[model samples]
Target: MAETMTTTQTITVGARRLEVSWAGVTHVGHRRETNQDSFLAEFPLFVVADGMGGHAGGEIASQSTVRRLHDVVDSADVGRSAIEGALERVVKDIAAHPETTDEGTGTTLTGVFIESDDEGSRWVALNIGDSRVYLLRDDHLVQVTTDHSVVQELITAGKLSPEEAEGHPYSNVITRAVGASELTPPDYVTIDVRAGDRFVVCSDGLTKELTDYGIQHFLRQHPTPGAAVDAMLAAALENGGRDNVSLIVVQVGDSSSTEDVHAE
Candidate 1:
């Protein structure tokens, strides 16, 4: 059976305290024989990794990548350099793994690392391929991460329109990924957090099936992070589950909120 996980946490950054409610879901989709996507939704960290290789290699690459992040989060060393160091280790580990080495496995990773500073709570959005991070603020949705893919390059070069690139045959061809090289440094940006902000991180499967407008519509309809996650997974399947789908929704609020953190 598929597993849907939900959790909440109260994080204190400097003098700012935030009660974060979050949930995640993963689906095998219609076309793929095996689900190669992996996610981590623990407080202070949320990530989605979409594996690309043969069946076995793809799964290994993604799982290994997340495992490394899991360790880093547990160690409570979520600084920029620490995250980059963990990713570097994963690249070497995957390169040495027999399963991935034989088939040339790689995976796209995108998500956020929450950290505290003198300024208050901040979110470090990270990306290393076509997977994406999006923000919803004041009822508006904005994509925060840039895709490192061939079609994205074309769009940047003014050679193709956004609509045209969406349907482009090379849409799935990513330019950078973990396990593809000995060193993979993700692109990241730090942003201040607000009480009403909502963040969505997902693999390409969700974007391929739903546009940004569609995602925003669902986020508006769902009252909580879990509801939004379910809505997205259902919409992807209804449209055409061409690839494995995975997503995590995180909502920020005051500590007085009724929601309490619980283990899955």
Candidate 2:
């Protein structure tokens, strides 16, 4: 909760170039003793992790994952392999550290990274748990990542509705994680980049307080990344910051010529 962190830079990939502005923020919140979330928002990648466990293992799990991810992204062109390899290293990284637990320590990893293929530059969103990535384009907001939690499974199976799943007893139970996988790997979604695209990469902390409508309203009201991030965090805390909050707001410049994308 210092001054809002903001950065604007030009990133070049292949023959394509993008002017990007981003802001990142994290808070311990009103109910948590330690902030169990970590994030890395750099040129080619932006990721958020929410750690779970006792005995400081949660902090270690989240910190290690982001550190390894930062190491993996120390290159010009980032792709799916880099994220997979980094996650693979996360296992070893946790093993080497005695601060972690066998079954208790794990993390929810989610984020968006820039990927370049033969055609052109694009966005690749990845997720392993309940953390989320939302894209706002042409005034429409879409959650690009799926949740791996118990309530989500029930909702998918038609056993529970969205409103019913909100306060469910199993809402906090995640079926898969980076340390303990429930026989599933991370999910990936590749998106074509546009100049006006805006994304929200966040932990459940932020979503627990803000509705999809609230998120879209804030993004629409604040065009700059820093302003949007600040507004969202303030709103989350005001509603009731029951969990540690963390998020990164990212935007691509030069939106004058991009076509409007409909929510499908």
Q: Tens digits of per-residue lDDT for model 1 on 1-264? A: 343455778877555677888999899999999999999988788999999888688898899889998998899877778878888888887788877755659889999878766655578898999999998977888898989999999999999999898678998898899885776688887766667788999999999899999999999999788888998999999999999999999988863222321212
Stretches off by above 4 angstroms in model 1 are 1-5, 101-103, 255-264
State the C-alpha lDDT per candidate: 0.85, 0.85
The residue pairs found clashing in candidate 2 are: none
lDDT of 2 at 156: 97
lDDT of 2 by residue, 48-134 (tens): 999987868788889988998888778554677777777878867766677777656889999888776676667778898899999
Error in Å for residue 17 of model 1: 2.9
